[model samples]
Target: MSRIDYSVWDHIEVSDDEDATHPNVNTASLFRWRHQARVERTEAFRKKGAELEEALAESKHELTRAHEKAGELAAGSSKARDDIERLKREEREWEEKVAAHRREEKKTPWNADTLCRGGFSKIAVINDVKTESVGEETETFMSFEKRYEKDVKRFAAMRSWDDSEEYLSDNPHLLCAETFNLLMMMCVDLEVLKKRESLEQTAHQAVVMRFISRLAKALKVDPRACFRRFFSKMKAADQRQLDTFADELECFKEEVRSAAKSPAWKAMDEAQRELEKEEERLEVFESLPEEMQRCFDRKDVRMLQEVIGRMEPAEARAHMKRCVKAGFWVPGAKVDGGDDDGGSDKEEDDA
Candidate 1:
């Protein structure tokens, strides 16, 4: 006969079931308070786990950089030797930190909510085509969109963490850097077009996507594997972290707005930068005094000089500054005093 196992019931936290309290005390309210406190404690523990993971990731990144730098130095150099020793010591320290954290995590008792959380043994197998690794695929924006656009839209439509989590769990391949980048661009595009409601929903999706990315980076795992953990954390009454995500969304929207109002804030190629610069110059030209604008419009250097000659010194200086900025005035034309052709040539060149 197989042995009956009863240890599975260990550490079961039943907030509603306990010995009766004093008659004057409200049992229901007390149970609610206890549940709240337990949730808060769990949330705090989750936050600490995230923080520790981040620190470990940073430490590993730093150690990798140190090794790369050390490899570039002379093998026998004193500095290289010192760095090697230092790196070894730092590596041991971080390993110890990680080991201690793992121990602590193991010591934490499972409550009713977490008792049946996902584990390797709990994963179900499905007979489906194998999904290609992202690293193996060259996914351009168009290809990524063509493949996952419908899934992304469906995800963006979800407003609840539980729903979003379930959707992503069904479609794990959508959890990737490419999807995050595309979603961010969509949010920015929506903001640019003043689609407030759509932008809000898209921005929400973008923030959640970013959280999954961060979780993956912290744990050194694929983002698709991190989505469940991220959603689980969000569902654990972690209101502060949710508020943080909301703040991130607001900041991202603000950045998009700022970039739309001023293209210089966004990175661009040389041609795009030149185009933006010309557009900016045209705006300045429009703001110039009417006489100055007309002079430039007519390509009349003589008229422009006459207009400047009539203005107060301070006003003329300001107008001249705008003219130079607008590519209408070249300070050093490299022309003979009486050569109109040379001046006109310089004006054409500047324009």
Candidate 2:
């Protein structure tokens, strides 16, 4: 058998927002047309089969007429016998054609789902409801997504990418959207944290992302499946290749750190500023109870607000004050409907 070429899916880009729509395309109409087309195709098959059955029924009528004609002829006449046999042969042929049509109807139906499943494969059977090496016992989709998100974020903050990879190797279930997105965000955060010396960290991030993407493309499986493959390949690589990666990583870091105006620094050495902000956020985060801390872990402002809402007025005020002071809530971060707009009311409130 020839190998499949899966290159078409290689460069497909996934939108950051799942429900985002293109203004130029009428997605509703497209879906409607597709559904209509599928219905018509299905009906077409049934209609053809119905027509075949009708013809077969007509042939049976002809056979009955021929038998009646034979009965009216002389009992020993060869002509009457030949007529009956000819009608019987025609009836048999019609019956065979109808049977063949029924078999044709049983062939697999084709559509988007078939294409996605790579055609004619069994409808996926979610066996045991549990993975072999990683993850908790099967839970609802929401619960699993949340659990993986938390774990992935926590793992992404590890000191080294290798450490992060190792964690993922152990907890393979985290090698998914939650993990990949958090990994990307982790790269951004590290870049933000390291104004000047982000080269090595960013390099590592890029390498990890590339490894996952390329392996996924090669294997024609989801990126999650290729996590182990990537690590194995890296582990088996030659020492010279390893040394080159390490030396280049360090050199890139040194080069970035040497830059006069790195993005992290914002044109002036703000090492203390970033550190102070991180310390403040952590302080605020640590002060919260576990339930409240969950909102922070998820970066969910509204949930945090709701948690605060249920508190006594004084308690809410105190929590808000601490959050404000710690820089957990940024001065100009956008809220629902709009952004801060840099107004004096916020300053008054802060003051």
Candidate 3:
């Protein structure tokens, strides 16, 4: 019986010997470890991909915002350029308007000579009047009226005329053939009252009358005025005379100025002589007593001294006594001492 069970024991012992030689191992465990490592690698790759996608989306959003901001800046720049262009255009237009106005102003008729002398051909019609008898006269009258109206309009425009209606209603004649020339002249001379640098009143009056006389003759109109225009032209003839006189006066003044520099003009010579004499007289007067001051100032002292020195002793004594009586010389002064002997002799004779 023991031999029969020994075969089973030999088989078991053979299996154990084979297991010891191979070493015990499990296929399922090896497979499971390799699968776990592969899963971890896949999960890490997926997470990295998600993070890259998020970063790409954020970059795209920032790019879009930058584009919109750039568009707004371009629009703002365009608007600023348009506004500047408009302002420039407006400035140019204003400058053009200013230039045009200045040109228009320059074209206006302001030549004093042309206005006064009726040089302009432009005319306006007055009411129908006697053409045959007073054609020339009427033209002149109308011209004057137009000139006066122009002046009144100018004054009104300047806001200088207070009584416009009254001035217009009065219809003051600037020149009337019927009135005395002197009256018109007087009106012209009134201009001098308003000015500090006018001709002398008497001289100006004379000049004005002379001018009016000629104007009346030339125009064959009465020299009359409802209102005076200050800067009217003088008659050509009278103006010529005045010009000649003024030229002569200017020449004379020039000569005087030249001669004054040279120390030779007669007036200056006379003035210098007078000044010297006055100085000499003042010196003498200053030395005299207050009571005798007037007499010394009045007399030529050098001449008086010579006269007294040349006089006979008796006459000189008499003169000294008179001077003493007049309070010009004090009785006990040196001037009175010269005649003392004569006075004593006279007193002795009287005794």
Q: Pick by lDDT: which candidate is best?
A: 1
User: Per-residue lDDT of 130-191 in model 3, one digit per residue for the tens?
Assistant: 65557776576556554564543332232222243244335444233322222222223333
In the range 1-351, model 2's lDDT, one tens digit per residue, is 769965555443233453455888787886677678777887898767755664565456556756766776778789878867887898798889889988775554445533365455457767666553433422444475566766755664556647867787777776554444445444445555664344344446544654466456544577766576556545778563365455545544444444424565453346646876888788778887776788778987667766765776666667666766775656567766785534422432544
Give the alpha-carbon lDDT of every model: 0.73, 0.60, 0.42
* Candidate 3 Cα errors over 4 Å, as ranges: 1-237, 266-287, 290-351
RMSD of each: 15.6, 31.8, 48.0
Relative to the true structure, candidate 3 reaches a TM of: 0.16
Relative to the true structure, candidate 1 reaches a TM of 0.41
List where candidate 2 sits over 4 angstroms from the true fold. Answer: 1-149, 157-166, 195-206, 239-351
Worst 10 residues of 3 by lDDT: 226-235
- TM-scores, all candidates, are 0.41, 0.30, 0.16
**lDDT score, candidate 2, position 135:** 39
